[model samples]
Target: MSVMIYPQGRTLSFVYGDERILVCREDRPKVTSRVQIKVYPDGRVVAAAPSDIDDHAVLVAVKKRARWIHQQLRDFRQQYEHLIPRQYISGESHLYLGKQYMLKVIESEDHTPQVKLLRGSLEVSVRQRHSGNVKTLLAEWYKDKARDVFARRLDAMLEHTLWVSERPQFRTRVMQTRWGSCSPKGCLTLNPYLVKASRECIDYVLLHELCHLAEHNHSERFYRLMNQIMPGWQSVKEKLDGMAHRLLLN
Candidate 1:
């Protein structure tokens, strides 16, 4: 039997054993019948059900699965607990091109802020005359570096992709989430934080986007193609996941 949708719906929030959860209802008809819930990496709880299924029903379902949600939250906390808020101050450690470097802040008479990797440190020259958050200054510096380095890497990797028939215009931005994205019009957007990652991880994100030119979704064939072009993509992906919380935490 097909499940008829109600056409109108809303999101209902409620507390379940001290944890806040959101139940989203929508009017999408379906032939399947099942209660679905997802716990995101960031500990957001979202549950969805058929349009005819009211908020109370969704809450009851969630209540029944409280133990499962607890386990998921525990696992996520263990995975991301190492990510600490950044202060963007000197003596703190940062990464560039997959290498760790200490941050060195220098107040200079010049008005323009500049950043450079010198020896084994990230030297940020800030103008004493200007007033702004040090984090913003460091982020802009990372954005500049990401643009220069990502463009070059994209160019080099393009030669290996059969899906890319032409060059894509790439731009860098401070994306709150996501490492990179590719549009059908051949424009690619990259996260500035990617500059702090390793070369292999950078290539993985770039190639993953490039592969979308042929198959826009994560189908089995997409993995096959990714393997054909880059055999060790999985190992590189693992490293990226481990370091993402530190590099991209907002």
Candidate 2:
């Protein structure tokens, strides 16, 4: 797992029965006494605690809520039947722009491997009919589409926020647990699988990264800015979160 530590805090772990839970601890200056514990869909437990709180206290707090965390993780895992591993073969369902398309694999030796969306189906023309080639072609196709879509969405989102004057450098990446990340240098790395989500979901992620251009951290002021700009972001986020399992299936 990638190490995610805040500037003011370090990573910590606690034993919950037999399972060891790793916590990404963040020491927020604005946090007074309450420790905010959030369990993400990726099963990462993030604790935003006061700067004065020590490692032991954080551990205790996480241990106290271990059962709840397990329940949340269980719910996330069992909520979707389609969460099973994707076979990437003909007749399998694939998602693009929040729409489901059946996979139609064709073995054609005369042409190079290519992926195309045609008549409610994702058609793959490959020289060899195998899972690996189909997977790679689909990934490349998604990456290509994401580049165009994200660029257009980014330009459109910039008009909504005045904080970003120029378009930032952005690239597509396949991440295990995150949809996107903005570097300290303002470069954006987005998950290629994000294209499987809807336009509003894509905009939410782009605007979220753009918000970081103004507010570097997830502070109260940053959320306030988000609320002002996207009033229904929380609802949008929930919809995206609900689709994470199916979207992130390998």
Candidate 3:
């Protein structure tokens, strides 16, 4: 178990193996303190408030939900234990464009790593000296690909779905927790792991972030608008959730 105190004065208590987390914050001057619990697919709970909340009260709320948290963690662990092993073997399967691609490792004197799709195969080339660094190298390649693909998808969604006038600046990087995030200023950040998901899953994430430009919260109106734009969004969302757990274990 570990406890962290944020600079913003909120406190967080987390249990790692059990994958449970609890947060407590103080209540505002005129507002009563309350606990807000959100369970993430990765088995984390986030509780938040203003500034003057009671710690014991927060603990009570978390304890009430402890059994549910433990169950989620157990199920997640059982489902993904096999995905935890790191393997860089040839013929290994990877996701791209909503399909699986077999990896074909090639030895080359090229100065930079490169990946090409050749007749149903993904050929990856890296410096021989860096052959043992396959995981990091491939991760970088995925990040680069995610940036390019996400940009195009974002543009398509904005042009077709919402008819937004302004183009938002976008960025991509590796994130441990979130698939993507959008800011009020129109900047969006995407997780590089998205490249490992199917093309439709990637598009789903892209559309999700783009939609934030219109509806910032996950309210009913937001989902209604999302469904209007993407008819099968619910199915895509489920697939993306499963893929996210697999990717995390990997």
159-224: candidate 1 lDDT, tens digit per residue: 899678898988887665578887777688888788899888888888888888777765556767
> After superposing candidate 3, which stretches have Cα over 4 Å from the reference?
1-84, 109-112, 129-132
Candidates' C-alpha lDDT: 0.72, 0.80, 0.65
TM-score of 3: 0.65
Cα lDDT tens digits, model 3, 204-230, are 777777677777865556667777788
TM agreement with the true structure for every prediction: 0.67, 0.76, 0.65
Top-lDDT candidate index: 2
Q: What's the CA error at residue 211 for candidate 1, in Å? A: 0.5
Clashing pairs in 3: 26-51, 26-52, 26-53, 27-52, 27-53, 97-199, 98-198, 98-199
- Model 2 TM-score relative to the real fold: 0.76
Candidate 2 off by > 4 Å:
1-9, 26-42, 48-61, 72-84, 110-112, 183-185, 238-245
Encode model 2's per-residue lDDT on 1-250: one tens digit a residue.
1112121247788876677877888765453677777776666677778767788898888888889987886775675443557788899999999999999999989988998899899999999988999999998899999999999999989899997888899998887667888888889888888999999999988888888888888767777778888988868876786667668776
Rank by TM-score, highest first.
2, 1, 3
Best-fitting candidate, measured by TM-score? 2
lDDT of 3: 0.65
